[model samples]
Target: MLPRPVVPAAATTGALLLLAACAPTVPVTAAPYATDPVCAAVVLATPDSLGDGLDRVATDAQATTAWGEPRDAVVLRCGVEPLGPTTERCESVTTPNGPTIDWVIVEDDGDWTFTTYGREPAVQLLVPGAVAESRSTSFVDALGPAVARTEQLRQCL
Candidate 1:
């Protein structure tokens, strides 16, 4: 057999680095109550995709997940502190075949953040403007089952 050419150490290192960079992982900060058992259920119940080609992506934090491209992903973080009465826009969402969930809506710079109203270990969703506009309630409805895993103590009146 002919002698094989050996790759240089630097070239091998560079190639490995390039491969590592190609693997996408969305950066997410774990919520304060991330370790709560309820959060585990929420994460487990989350859908693999949010429709419109938004597939689930790996996350760097516990009880956190993201869907869609990293640059414009829809992020979900479980185990946030529960919300008491709030003046923020709240809505009661009833999914077609899932449980009804209450969410407090907040908008910042065209991005929408929705948090479960009164669940002990609340779930938060950071939705990009474009995706929210296109999917509207569909995305939230898709997540209702997961969010519903937590016990809701209050709702929009």
Candidate 2:
């Protein structure tokens, strides 16, 4: 009979701790105004999960967050440059029993990028096609409160 090898409890715990600490960090570029104090408030107010099993992930940049797998993560970056009047499609997303936010939509390669229209230190969300098709406005709704931390200066008209 072969003897079973014993692993030390402390060593096993240390290995588990190391693995837990090694969660992948989502790479995101910090926005030009990422250091703005309002960005912190927005980040702090963001929900831990965006429904549909999409949970917040660690980001490499300030005022940035991601949910779900890196390849198809819903990324949000606070402190993006505020938008001015534009002819692009703008949608006013009103969360259920929550705040209303205006987002200017830009599409590229079947992906949608939504940026806040009226808020200074604006926030931007990159939604992959699959998630957009599956989740629709849930992501935006989940983020409404966080993005609304900054006052709205205008509305989609």
Candidate 3:
């Protein structure tokens, strides 16, 4: 048998330790703020409790957040350009008297896409079909109150 190249014991130990320390850390890309100040405050006031099954992913933006690590299932983007005078249906969500926020919801292939209406510099959330089934209200409800601090005055009627 050909003699195996002997790797030093010390070298093997160092390799193992290096591999252990090199675990991947996924960093979420932050969404642009559209240069709005209100969006910044909402991010600061965001609630820490997002409920079970959803994890707050590490993000680059103060106003952007993802619900999964490495891969995002639910993404929240604040300060998107607001839609003006659209025929799309709007639903008013009742909050704990913070600020009334209306949502323009679109569902396709089980995926739920939500954008804040009756507000300037809208906030958008993309909820995957699978995630929406398990955690429909929990994620949106928690973020609503926080984002409501922006104080949208327009009504969705």
Provide the RMSD of all predictions against the true structure, rounded to 1 decimal: 4.5, 3.8, 8.0
Candidate 1 lDDT, 58-154, residue by residue in tens: 8899999999988788999998888889999998888887799999999988799999998878999999888777766467888988888898787
**Each model's TM-score, in the order given?**
0.83, 0.85, 0.71
Judged by whole-model lDDT over C-alpha atoms, candidate 1 comes out at 0.88
Better of 2 and 3 by lDDT: 2
Summed over model 3, clashes come to 0
TM-score, candidate number 2: 0.85
lDDT of 2 at 34: 95
| lDDT for each residue of candidate 3 in 1-157, tens digit (9 for 90 to 100) | 9999999999999999898667433453444554588877776666654667566654555567666533545777787767677688787777665555788888899988788887766788888778777655545766777678665757788
Lowest summed lDDT over 10 consecutive residues: which window, candidate 2?
A: 130-139
lDDT per model, in order?
0.88, 0.89, 0.70
> Residue 101 CA error for candidate 3 (Å)?
1.1
Pairs that collide in candidate 2 are: none
Best by TM-score: 2
Comparing 1 with 3 on TM-score, the higher-scoring candidate is: 1
Whole-model alpha-carbon lDDT for candidate 2: 0.89
- The sequence of per-residue lDDT tens digits that candidate 2 reaches over residues 1-157 is 9999999999999999899789887899999999999999999999998886688888899999999887788899999899999999999988889999999999888789999999988999998887877766556877888898998899899
